[model samples]
Structure formats: structure tokens, C-alpha cells
Target: MLWEVDQKVKEAADALHPSSNVDHMQNILQDTLIHCWELLLKRHSATMQIDAKFQDLLFRALDYYVVGRLHEMLWWLVCERCQVVDQLVKTRLSHLRHAHLSALQLGVPAHYYTPLPAAVVELASLASVESAIGRLQCVHSTIELIQAQAKEARVTLHQYKDQEGEPELELTKEELMALLTTVVVQAQCSHLVANIYYMTHYVFSVTEDDPLWKSLGLLRNTLENIMKLDVARLPQPAKSIRKELSLQDLMQVSAEVESRFEAKGPSRSIGDITALDLQLHQLTQQIQLSTQAHSETHLTERNSPSRRSDRTMLSPTQDNSKSHSFREFLSSIPSSLRESLRRRQSQQRSAIQSSLNG
Candidate 1:
């Protein structure tokens, strides 16, 4: 009876009711095994397959059936050893339950185990060989969502065209290009934001600071760089719109990313040159604070040990080193417009000399 039920389960394919049929078979086999000690050796022998060892042969047969093998010929060797069938059923059920729970936790689709009738493929980006299967599952969900949306849009568009005339559906060439550009820019920004948020979150969640934090720091720097680049690249209206939208909300989605990256303070991930200028102002303040606490002279210029001058008075080595470092720092300040800074300083010095002469 257990063997017959197992055969039926195999034939059912996706329709297999393991909860009812499979469990029932396992229980019947377990009860039979518990009572079979009183039976004659010949009576029990008739139940066993051609193999001399009844239980061992049944185990091998049951192994073939439980692992999704549907054919009956593979189990001909152990037809009556109920003990093997019970173990196989228990093992299979345990495996299935584990897989189902894991899938549910990972937001996998319900039919995750119902293998697609196609050749299996692999992805290079998959974390491991096993992840290829998970990625395929993600792809399946994405495709389903896309299909549903496309179908709904098609129906709505057809109805709109019928009621409003085909001419109303067409857009001007410039309008179409503008719409496309807006879409492309938004898509790119969204991708960058996602990368920044995840990378930041991954970095701060670690207990011991790993080199991965450097990678995260690089990402944060890149985000700052991109924000500047975008500000410089995007049109004023678009830049204003982005500022109005609040880029911090994007970073704040993941908790760890939010904790590591402050939305307030002087540093901002995106905006005008003014925001970056504010950060530079803060750095200059820190430098002044350190110098006031330690250095005797205002322009001691303690940058490199090799470049440090022995004389308390300014020397070419100290002056040149300070000038070089200041220039290097100013190079990052785009709007300071170096030529203007040079001319304005020269003008100020002339004004001071004129006052001394008077």
C-alpha cells in the first residue's frame, strides 16, 4: 500500500500532496515495521525484494524515490522494507520544510522549487554557484512584474487612443528627447544612490575595521565627487529639483548608512560648490585650532619634516612648502578661482603699503 501511494505521488508531478499521501504512507510503514517481529521469516521474506538483506535494500530504493525520482523500476529492489520508506519520507520532508522557510525569509516566490522546464544557466555576478539559482528566482519575479505592468499599460493606452484620437498620443521631438533625458538622469542617480547606501551600510556594520571600510570611504568620497560632478554637469533647474528632493532621504533608507553619514553638519553628499566650500572652511578652522594650541608663529608651516626650516624666521623652504600645500588645497576649491585669489592678494598688499606710506 505504501509503495502504491509513493508511485501515485510520482505521477502527480506538481500536484503531489506530500502532507496527506506521503505522510500517510510513512505512518503506515512505521506501524508495520514496529509490529513485524511476530511475523514468520518466510512471510516477511515474501515482502522483501530479491536482495537477502531486506532493510538495507529498501533504504537504497527509497533514497531514489524521495529525491524527486518518479520512476518505479528504480525501487524494484526493495518493495516491502517499510522502515527505509519511513526514513526517506522524514528526510525529504525535513529538507523541503527547511528550503521553504529559507525561501520565504529571502522573499522568494512560492513556486521556488518547481524547477523551470529549461536548460539551467549561470551568472558571473552570482555570489556562489548556488546563488545562480537564487538570481534566476529573482529574474523570474522581475519578469512577472514587468509582464503585468506592460499588459495593464497596453490596455490603458489602447483605450486612451480610442477616446482621444491618435494625434493626441504623439509628442514633439524636443519634448520626447527631454523626457528621455530626464528618465536616463533619474535612473543613473537612483543607481548611484543605491550603491552608496549599500556600500556605506556594509562598511559600518563590521566590528573590526576592515580594508572594506576603505572601499566604503572611497564610495563616500566618490559620492561627494559625483555630487559635485552632477552639480557642475546638471542644468540649474534640474540641480534645484534634486536639492528640493533631498538626497539624504535616499542614503537614510538603510540604518547603518544613515548612522555613518550625517545629513546635517557641514558635509553634504550633493549640492552647489557652496556646500563643498563650507567643508573646506571647517577644515581650515581645524588647522587654525591645532596651530593656536601648538605653534608659536602664525605661519610656522609644519607640513613635511624634510621641508621644515631650522630658523624661527620664514625661509624659502618653509615658504615654498607652505605655498605648494596651500595651492594643492586650493586646487580642490573650484570657485575660489585661483587667478582672482592671486590678484586680490596682490591688490590687498599694495593697499597696506599705501596706508603705511601715508
Candidate 2:
């Protein structure tokens, strides 16, 4: 039945040219979905009464299958006609494939398996659409939810064995990246490159300072970093049963295993937002350090020791103006770095006060 649906979808996709508009593509997909749904219902009605769980699974499977096939067809059309796949798109696709193969090698334990979060699935689905605002909104909401979960230590670490103690409040960057790689592999969404290209070409009202814009950047970086991660370095399941399977073999096994399990109740959260936040902070620090070094060099070349001393010995008004400028600079820093700086400053003040009292 699925093969029949697949054939029909392929036929519909075959009719589309590389220059087809978004609506033409959407209409083909929408019509295919409606037809597939009716076909599935008829087949199930003859055998057994479809329960909610089965229905949910059916639709999800259909969505993934139809969308994936359609995307492949569209990708091939573009490649055949345009004679070029964007280099970044090719890199991402390669990364996703590599990550999937690495994950298969780990042989993650059944009990440890964490299904992709619903929001993450929705994020991928929205990326396929043409609506920039809608996609941005979904991205923002998804990142926010993932951040909340991470803060609460609720994101499951599938690669690690369960411990007797409470979960750690903070996750390291490696752990976060490993979990993200797993989620992306399991998502199996197609046309990632095309979706990203579409968004890049479309102009929207987002800015660099906005959290939404930051979230978008974080997501893109996460996807890119997938290729760089070494699955062997991540914490392994204690009882993993290693299997030597080819990529095709692993994919087949995965599909079979997935079919056996009903979708687990929202098994885990998504996004390594904390890891990305730390990355952003490190980047900001590097820029600040470079600027400071340049300033120091320029100051050393221009100012004599006596002049430097005179400049340092400021009046109350000059000190106030300097402090105001410093505050303004702090305001421009990313929130995470600003908070870290605030904590460090408070700790230093406490230490100085204690020393004076002593």
C-alpha cells in the first residue's frame, strides 16, 4: 500500500519542472497526502479498526515518506537542470549521512533510545514551507522550549547509562552535541539544503540582535557541526550490542525497529541551545580580546608613561563618564556573556570587601 502511495507521489512529482512555483509544489504534495490518507484508511478499515496511536503513526509515516520522496525529486530536478548543488547543501547532506552511520555503529540500547521531540519535527516541517515568518516563529518557540528543558535538566542523554544519583544540572558541549546529532539522524528530514537556501534568499524583518535571529544562527551551526562530531568520543551505552552493518543495512534495520515501537511519549527535548550559548560567548570574548590588544598596542605607541599616569588619575567627573561608557559597552555584549561578567564582577567585589574586613 505504501509502495503504491509512493509511486503516485513520484508520478505527481515527475510532472513538476524545476521552475515550478511553491504553490504548484504544495498542491501536488497536498493532493498526494489526501489520496494516501484515503488509501490508508480503506486498507486499515478492512483489516482492523484504526486506533488513535495507529492513526498517528500512519500519518507521521506518510508525512515523512511523502515529503522525503518529494524533496528528493525536487532536488534531482534542480541538480539536473541547474547542474549544481550548493556546496553548503552538499556538506550538510554528507554530515547527516555520516552522523546516521555513526549512530548505527553505536548500537544504542533500546531502553536508551530517545525519539525526536515533536517541536523539532515541526521545525523541520516548517522549514519545508515557503512562509519565512511562520518558519521563524516556529524556530523561536522550539528553541525556547528546548532551553527550558535544558535548564531543568530534563533533556535525556541517550548515550549515557542511567546513574543512581540525580541528573546533573549542567550539560557539557560534547554531550549536548551528541544528543543533537542523534536527534537529527532520527528526524530523517529531506531537502535540508534547499530549505536553507530558500530562507537565505528570502528577506525578512529579523535582526542580528534579536533572540530569534540568534536561534536561527544556533540551529544552522548545530546542523553544520554534525559532521565534525566524533561519535566514538561520546559516552557509550553500557550494554550496546555492536553490529557491523553497512549504511543501507542499518537504515533498513532502523525502519523495521521504528515500525515495531509505537511513537514513545515525547521521549526527550531538542536543541543544544546552552552549548551554542557558550559558543557565542567564546566568540564574543575572542573579538573583545582582539580589540583590546589592538587598543593596547595603539595606546603604547602613542602614550608616554607620564601621559598614561596622567590619564589614569581621572577626576570624579571623568571616572563617572568612564563608568558610563563601560556600562554601555557591557549592554552591547550578548546576554550570556554579560551575565557571566556580572557574576565575576560581583565575586571580585565580595573578595575585596572580605580582604579589607580581615
Candidate 3:
């Protein structure tokens, strides 16, 4: 039944739910296939030519239905982010509890104070992606009692007595301000990464056919004016949310173009793909140059934890040779802004150094 779609989606709503398997995710994917089949095969065929009334009515209905669906999806995103936070809390607490128990058993009460040294914060700075950065931020926020190492890898601990008068770590107001800013910024970056990956997969899926790949890639890139996957600037918190939203429109346009070109109606071409091909090539070259600059920057520096993530993530050295879709997308982006991206990276390093020096 069509209601199974809603039921399956409900099951996946809780990311921590035990039954939330890859199969449930597949069910959601299959739900889309089912809808496509129903629309193509089960629906009654149009008996006559499209009428003005039907067209007008359809547009009006879409205005209401589409808006509602957008709100629903947004709510879903909020729920997903909350679940991510929940999982982080559970995981961290589980570790802390184990450490606490171990300390009690060993008769070394000091181990209960801080299980792991705050130096790991330095390690966190090199998180492979922004989403990982965001998830780590959530973990940092939920537990007020933990050692935190700042940018210079110096551990700062604010330990006080708990209800039992034992020592515990805590965050101060100023520290909270910094941590909250990081949490929010990391969350935004994570969302941006999530959307980018989602759009990448969506585009690749639509363009997987023999004749469509090159043209569709160009069409999507043209619509987005994307150069180098725009990776360099994301280290800075987004200036405008709409900037990412516009990139998101790339996939929407790709989807629309796909439905039109592949449908079983009057065959039409969106003109020559030569221009599109040239554009894609130029964009990819630009990104490759940018990626190289980013890599050089990576070699020259290592900084505080928060800043470290951007450094390594900007030019991922791991597994780019793999034929994965996201890797291919990142590797192919043109680096027209390679110099600018490098300059920004330099500025960021300077700022970080200044912060450390201060």
C-alpha cells in the first residue's frame, strides 16, 4: 500500500532506532520507484489534449502541495540534526561511564577526573569533513565537564567538585560562547556538506546513461556556475544561507532537465553539448588547480583543532583516485579561483596564528 511509504519513513525518523537498517533506507528509495511506476503505468491515460483549465488548476494545486512538502522536508531536517546530537550524547556518555567505572575499580580516583587527555582536541581539528566537524561540536557541547584544548593544543581544564564533592570539569561563560559559536558554525558546514553530497548523488544518478552524462553535467554546472565545487570558501561560515540554496537549485534544474529530456514525448535537444563539455572541462581544471593550492597549504601548517579540520578537509588526500561519485565530483571541479582560494587559506592561517600568538 502507498501508506507503507509513510510507515517506512517514520521508522527511519529516529537515527538511533535499532531497526533503522540499510534496508529501511532502501525502502525509502524504493518508495520513489513505486511512485514513478504508479505515475507511468497505473494512472489513467489522458483522453484528450491538455486544456487551459487543467493546466491552471494543476499549477494552483502545486502551489499549495509543494509548499507543504517543503515545510515537511525542513521539519525532517531539523529532526535529523537533533537525532545526530542525541547519538553523539549517547556515544560520549557511554565512553565516560566506562571510564568512570574503570577508575573506580582501579582505586585511582584521578581517572574519573578526565579519562582522555584534552590533547585529542588537536586530533579533532583534522576531521576529514565538515560534517564530522559538526558532529564533534555536538559532542563538545553536550558534556560541559570535559578537558578542552584550544587552538595551540594546550589543554584547559575547569575542574570543580560534583554533588559528592569529587572533582569534575566544567565550562565557563566565555568558553561556552566559543563552544556555542563552533557548534553552530560546524552545524551549518555539516548541513552544507550533506546537501552537497546529496546533490552529487542525485546528479550522478540522473546522468548515468550513455548519452546524458556529459550534457547533464554541463547543464547542471551551467545552472549553478559552480567552479571547483566551491570548497575553499566553506571553511568560513556561510555568508548567506541562500548561497547554498542556490547551489541546491543545481540538482533541481538537473532533475527537471532529466525528466524533460528522457520522457516519452516529443524528442528535443537542448542544443549542442559542446559548450557544456568545454565548460565542465574548464571548471574541473580550475578545481584541480585549487585543490593543489589547498594541498600545499596543508603541508605548510598545522593549527588549533577547529582550524585544523578546514586545512585537511579543503584538499582531501585520502582516496581521491577511487571512482566514488563524490570523489569524482571534487576532483573534476575547475580551479579558476585557485589563487583566491589560496589567498583566503593564507589569510585564515594568519588569523589562526595571530589567535595562537595572542
Worst 10 residues of 3 by lDDT: 153-162
* Model 2 bad stretches (over 4 Å): 1-116, 151-176, 230-236, 241-358
Candidate 3 lDDT at 204 equals: 12
What lDDT would each prediction earn against the true structure? 0.30, 0.47, 0.32
After superposition, candidate 3 runs with Cα above 4 Å error: 1-24, 39-41, 46-192, 200-205, 209-358
Better of 1 and 2 by TM-score: 2
Residue-level lDDT of model 1, residues 42-104, one tens digit each, is 244433523335533343233233322322321221222223332332232232222221211
Going through the candidates in order, what is the number of backbone clashes in each? 0, 0, 13
- Tell me which of candidates 1 and 3 scores higher on lDDT: 3
Q: Please write out the lDDT profile of model 3 over residues 1-358, one tens digit for every residue.
A: 3355344334434332334432343234333333332332223234311333443343333222322223344334433533443333233333222222221122222212223223224323423322321323233333232224231111111121112343233434334333332222222232332322222321211213322233223323322321122233333321111112233454454454445434624422323222222233344556557767887564323332332333333333323233243334434433121343335434543453343344
User: Which pairs clash inside model 2?
Assistant: none
Better of 1 and 2 by lDDT: 2
lDDT of 3 at 256: 49
- List TM-scores for all candidates, in order: 0.16, 0.34, 0.21
Among all candidates shown, the one with the greatest TM-score: 2
lDDT of 1: 0.30
- Write down the RMSD of all candidates, one decimal each: 34.7, 26.7, 30.3
